[model samples]
Target: MTTIAVTAPHAPSYYAASGLPQPARPALAGAVQADVCIVGGGYTGLSSALHLAEAGFKVVLLEASQVGWGASGRNGGQLVHSYSRDLDVIEARHGAAVARSLGSMAFEGAAIIRERIERYGIDCHFRPGSMFAALNERQVRQLEHHQALWQRHGHRELELLDAAQTARHIGSGRYKASLLDRSAGHVHPLRLAQGEAMAFESLGGVIHEASPVVRIERGDPAVVHTAAGQVRARFVIVAGNAYLGGLEPQLSGRSMPCGTQVIATEPLGERFPELMPTGHCVEDSNFLLDYFRLSADRRLLYGGGVIYGARDPAHIESIIRPKLERTFPQLRGVRIDYAWTGNFLLTLSRLPQVGRLAPNVYYSQGCSGHGVTFTHLIGRVLSEVIRGQAGRFDAFAGLPHLPFPGGRLLRVPFTALGAVYYDLRDRLGL
Candidate 1:
């Protein structure tokens, strides 16, 4: 694994500058015994620890850095439903039976987030409504099919808007139309992650920040070792995602770490509502899409673009500012207050990889860019599996995962070339 300095702070993003104050957690020192051991402090690990602790299991969670310090704290905060690949693609690849099952759980993750906020009184800025802005007739047709597919699967909260209607709602003339999912929403992602960790601690779960697991000994009771401590538990879950480098060779080859950048503009003041009249979160329909939403304090949190192998650029703003200006030319001179970069585990099929390595060693990763809501679902399902209920967990594990082509050395460059082809297609409106 890439060794993280113990004193590393949260990324200098808007999330770190203005979210709720997170509690300080100590590093793991002495050996501990628990029913379950979890690695990573992001949404997946924190949610797993919270759910497991609520199920009356002794849980210990270890993080290389502070809670929500990774992509969990650095996402665009769109609480979107479903997987990266929609149900139609899933049905085409797998079978209708599998698609039906996945479709049923598509909205469950968003619902879980709502319930947790109410149950725990989390202070994350929760907002309703998410829309996919269509730039052309082809995109509009896709949204039409998307709305119909979700409606068929019992998601009736979607409403398709014509070009005029879309312009009125979002106050942007760029889109031909949009599909609004009132059930989908946005939030202060970092706060939600930290709040989940706080809730877990309240339930007697133990957390050790800055304690990265270096090795895992697979046995009856798994032994997870850190530099200064070790956890002996009946079950172990690896939720490190993109940051989990070189840990488990058998499970790591199927996905690649892809980088993305985000920029938060200085408070938009009165211009915020003019850009988005309905105050809903907006994501484009392009394969490489732009997702933006207004923060509670009225700042625009915009994120887009991707790079395989996750080589972060030195000046994030230099690259992303032009993308933002192209989307909203009205905000051409708007000053960006913060910019940060993070990576998500991307799979070849653009679907998550969930399965058990050993009987007692489980993992869930490769949510692609759709990790915000799905991580919560995976966490709950993981807890269910550890508690003798494996139906939901098995459903996801059954999904096929293929390794990235070109092996480790060539996969990055190969994916970069593939991205170029896709970008051209997007530019040509294909």
Candidate 2:
């Protein structure tokens, strides 16, 4: 068991380079008391803290690093609906009742983000429209089914585009079809996180940075011990996703920390529009996928290449640049300005793992790399469960979260081998 820490500046991603300035938050000092003590400072934790504080609860949030320090601030920034696995898969593995319940709230997370930006006046470059592109006939058929499946769940805002239409919007010939969701959007993630932290503070919530919880003395009033301080609270929420290593044995086993790297090019200026004609964030339909979008300043932000364990590529660009060039050959020599990597929790079920770790201790993790939007929704659900509205929370809890077959020790190798099969299928257009 190891602990993750980041007593440093945010990664040099383009989002961090251009996002709004943030106030330096203080670390936990002495002993503090609150109705709730939330661990982690990423999307889920911040969202949970903000909503909980707004609900009139005294909240204290502890982050090992600054806000948006993990994947929350370092994702591809393409916000869309649905879980990591599609709704049909959820239905097949679970059941209609469970799938329907999860599907109904699929779009709510994106709505929550938009509402936050509008309500808190957060300037995270909230841009609407997300496209799921199909690269082969099999993928096209899958998308066709995806559209119908979403429609059955009361989602009718999807716009299907033929190859020509897809080309028009995508400015690339690699895709055969597209499913566009007008309500889904992209944002400046780091800024959104920072803005959210500010809003939480404004709502009388307290945030302690660099105060990694070293131990949790669980009880009626759980005590969360940090390196230099402790939080005694009525309830505790563990919102740390992938960056949370070894904090709890149960959590580390049921979830695997998967690493993904992304790169941002030097301001593309006029060339940006040629690449993303409509400026809609796009992700291709594949088991392991590629997602890209234009930054507010017009730099092309491309992300791909997933690693099952914690080792990041020696140089992220060395792995991602080829994908970027392959996707847009015209930008063969494009100057890469920023490259970095972050980890997201992946569950064996490919669904989010959310429920109580103890009677008074709750947790939410493993968004399966599709967490940017879902985290916000889970945040609300967590707050609701903490306050006695367990109906919605129970829906997620009812879903099974199996531990990796080989546990943490061999889960990485086993999962990586399984992924190679799907990667071949994707390559063969199966």
Q: After superposition, how far is residue 29 of candidate 1 from its true place, in Å?
A: 0.8
Worst 10 residues of 2 by lDDT: 1-10
For candidate 1, write residues 59-102 as lDDT tens digits: 99999888888889999998999999999999999999999988
Flag clash pairs in model 1.
none
What is candidate 2's TM-score against the reference? 0.97
What candidate 2 gets wrong by more than 4 Å, as runs, is 1-6
Give me the runs in candidate 1 sitting further than 4 Å from their true place: 1-5
Q: How well does candidate 1 match the true structure in TM-score terms?
A: 0.97
lDDT of the candidates, in the order given: 0.89, 0.89
Candidate 1 at 54: error in angstroms?
Answer: 1.1
- Residue pairs whose backbone atoms clash in candidate 2: none
TM-score per candidate, in order?
0.97, 0.97
Tens digit of per-residue lDDT, candidate 2, span 1-430? 4334446678878877887887777778788899999999999999999899999999999998889999999999888898988889988998889888999898799999999999999999988999999989999998889899989988898999999998888788888999999989899899999999999999999888888888989898999998777899999999888988888888887888889999999987775466777879999988889999988888889998789986788799989899888878888999999999888888999999888888999999999978989999999999999899998999998988898888778999999999999999999998
